[model samples]
Target: MQTQGHDLVSTLDERTSNIRATIENVLVLPLSRHPSPRSVLIIGCGIVGAATAFFLARRGVDVTIIEREGPASAATGAADGAVSVASKRPGPMMVAALSGVALYRELLGDGTLTDLFKPRSTFVVAASDAECAVLEAHAGALRGEGVAVEMLAHETLIARFPALSSNVRMGAEVKGDGHAIGYRIVNRLLSLSGVTVLRGVEAYHLVEAADGRIVAVATSRGELSADAVVIAAGNGAPTLLNCDGVMKPRKGQLLVTERAPALNASMPGSIMSGRYLLSKGSQKGAEVSARGYGLVVDPLVTGQFLIGGTREDSDARQTNDLEAVRHILTDAVAMVPGLADIRLLRAFAGVRTAVIDGLPLVGRLPGRNNLFVAAGFEGDGICLGPVMGQAIAAMACGETPSLDLSSFDPARFTSLEVAA
Candidate 1:
């Protein structure tokens, strides 16, 4: 297993050599016009923070990341890595999700993520009449956005994916969706950017100057000053920004299964349950409860299966309850009966930070020019992390972001009044 992992790493290194050289050349070159924030401090080491540091460093800005835990020790380390837009509605989030997917593809082409990203379609399946109806409308929305989608009838679905159970009434093959492991992507970005990461440091408060600009961060270790500050610390942001009411924790449980090469190979892509749309409140009339179970069975490159989980309005991250695990597996096995034979390997949970309004906070704070917030992505962090990081980095440098972030501006939460 170690030898195989080493060989895979070597192959990826070879694949990324050309692009790595180009990026390194750009990094070594001095910038003609110095950006205002010559030095920036980021308050997280998750994927979003790592990506933000990478983009900032790439633009010749000195970047330092401080985290309460090690890299990917929080939600980023626990994500399912679904780079998908199939679950989003036709709104700002959907648009951002599309851009996020494009960015992943762009990174892959440039060898920045050649091996880390796996491009494949997401199959959203329906097992009931009500589910099929919701799925049809969802497919229409995806098509309207020019997303490649194939609405499969029951017979066609059975023909295409024989591993799926007979209970699957229909399925929609949403192309351009992909899967990636969260921790791997975070590590790669950090390695490529080569920025300083201060682990085991807790960021407590933001030190502001009389001019209403964030000048430093008060940490557990000591006060660290910087030209600019970014609060992307997930659950930690609400306290630092004094907007506790704006962010809440949503827990999710995920499971992994032992290797099943033949069963894994049978599926072309990850399987998303139609009920997941309802659970995520993607359907207009769908009501989301305090606890909802959404099924997603993803086949990994190592011939293992990744299944998940329950979305609960709780902050319990260290433990997974039997009820949630049982419900998730029941749904997963119902969709793909072949999973019944596979032994369960592991079950873990993570608490994702979600905003009250659903949309993420990804732009400059209301009146703080050098202060930025990029948290509250909920479950979409894995998909939006890198792209939003690049955008936030641009915003910090007083440049145009790759994606329009007006919809996600931090000013939306009026209660978040930063102390000057």
Candidate 2:
């Protein structure tokens, strides 16, 4: 790794140059002419921020993270931990999801994420005729995208997984999906990185140099100086970036059941309803409503079942309404009759930041050379957080990211008036 004050004026690699050239809509601003950063300040301690700090620390850079609360106290601690590509549409997000999952595999192999990631298949089932049609088309799309898929008829589905209810007409097994608890990953990354975290501190604004570089941050405690800054605070990012109105908070409710080893072992992997395709707008011609209900019954390694949830536009993280809970449980029981016998252990809700355009805001913030942003991933954050962090850390060090990040560039939003 290069030292501080090192000049970074190397030509782009052939692959990177081709990707940059293909990106037509983004502003394509040049990296700062200043030397590479010696110190980096991360504005969130969630999974994304933690992962960023981890990569930066690995590169021998001084990294410090500031969080409004304890690590993973917000969305990261409350997520379902599904590192899945089965629910993604075939677009930039899908491409990113594939890369994200691949990174998870790499981290697992390198022991950075040992026992933190659990690889498995996701079985999606359809109970009604309409859902069956959607399931078939979705399965075809997944195969077209080179995703390993197997269509299961009613008999084969029930025989292979007797835990499912008789209502399931058909199913599709999506391979290469996995699950990991969000808070666990955050803690592991922070521990491995050995970076200091300022809990209970909040950043209010960015301080800029005369040459339009972000040199410091104004926070509740005081002003902290750094060579570079990254805003990964989800919804909290819009205000600090001074780029409001681009992202909004979306809420989801989930439930956990008591140990049911017999039922859990009967299934080979997590079960997703065909409706999830429509809810996520993965099915062609499907519209994503403000409030959508999708079912996913995940069997945890602890012999418990994790069931979820409703996607509501409002940001009500502290409360789970009775209507949503009842509907989710009803759907779960309908899909798996044995679930009706298990006792409910807990019900919780989380608020995730979602951009209006669906894609997350990553890479350098437009017009702010030393500033970067990686937030608004919505539900995909758990899957994409680490990879996006790796990309941001590379950018902060004046290197081209391995993945094509032009699609997620913050410069795509013209109305974003970011003031230093």
Candidate 3:
């Protein structure tokens, strides 16, 4: 077993000359202007913050992104870039996902996102009876919402995807979903937005007026007086806002294979498991797993296969979990035996903030009207980041958001607010 793992890594490096980098480090394209922002101090430079700055800049809002690190250095950088609705459990999460999917199409339609976006047919496969039932119900829910979904039975699953093993019992294909590299989207959005990015700075405290309106932020760099403050910091947002235990960091791992177009007809789109279903939130449709060892196979546009992951709730920055890698490999090989033959280029890991209820915080705090937060995406940040940014930006400009934010109110988890 040890020899096989060594061989897999060694063979891939020899075969592929160049493979794209994952989430820890995002490429920064040099920009000419660094505008002064008297409007809003947006903390965190990940996808959510960057997107907020992106749309806000378009609306002529003076926005500044203060980051402890560079852009896409958190969950946004480490994600598989799945703009998928298939993984979301039915209800509010699914509703936001549909809107997010539509928003991504609009972004792609414009010249904003070029070769970065590509259409994918998402396939959700299940190994057990429990998992299959969940997949079916998921397909039904999506269909009811006008999402294009088709169920593939055992025979059809094998016929369409010969790479999968005989044990594969069922599968469902989700249409109209697409894929994008997380870092690419963040880097491109920042480059195009031209917002002031203050890297290597930390937001220490959020200052507010006597009337409870947001005023300024005391940071490591200096005092940043702002008309408003939008906090898009991932796991760090809770700590800064004194809402610590509410948003916890959930770590994930993924392995990327070398360019192998022959790997399951280029693997079409992402292959998910019903096990993936259980992690989103409380769903009675079927019990998958809270930490879904669910398998996701993404065929990259560059002809690589991105397979992931294990969900661990810890703040430890260690991304390489040997045990998690083993489970991921075993799951990948069982579903698609062809994956065993392919060489693995590298394994990537990152942490995402997960809300216990499995929904992101996207609106204003109960008390601080001028303070807004967009965090706790847990792995869904890539899909919802753009729309969340657009919505938050509109709010900062004193305009109503385009999408319904009744579900993502930050006060839901607050004892006082919830009691009220």
Per-residue lDDT over 285-361 for candidate 3, one digit per residue giving the tens place of the 0 to 100 score: 34324355667888887788899887776434746868778899998888888888889899988888888677899
- lDDT, candidate 1, at 321: 84
How does model 1 fare in lDDT? 0.84
TM-score to true structure, per model: 0.91, 0.91, 0.87
Model 2 scores worst on lDDT over the 10 consecutive residues at 3-12
Residue 361 of model 2 has an lDDT of 95
lDDT value for candidate 3?
0.76
Tell me the TM-score of model 2. Answer: 0.91
RMSD of each: 6.8, 8.1, 11.2
lDDT of each: 0.84, 0.84, 0.76
Model 1 off-target regions past 4 Å?
A: 1-35
Candidate 1, residues 357-392: lDDT per residue as tens digits? 888999889888788999999889899999999999
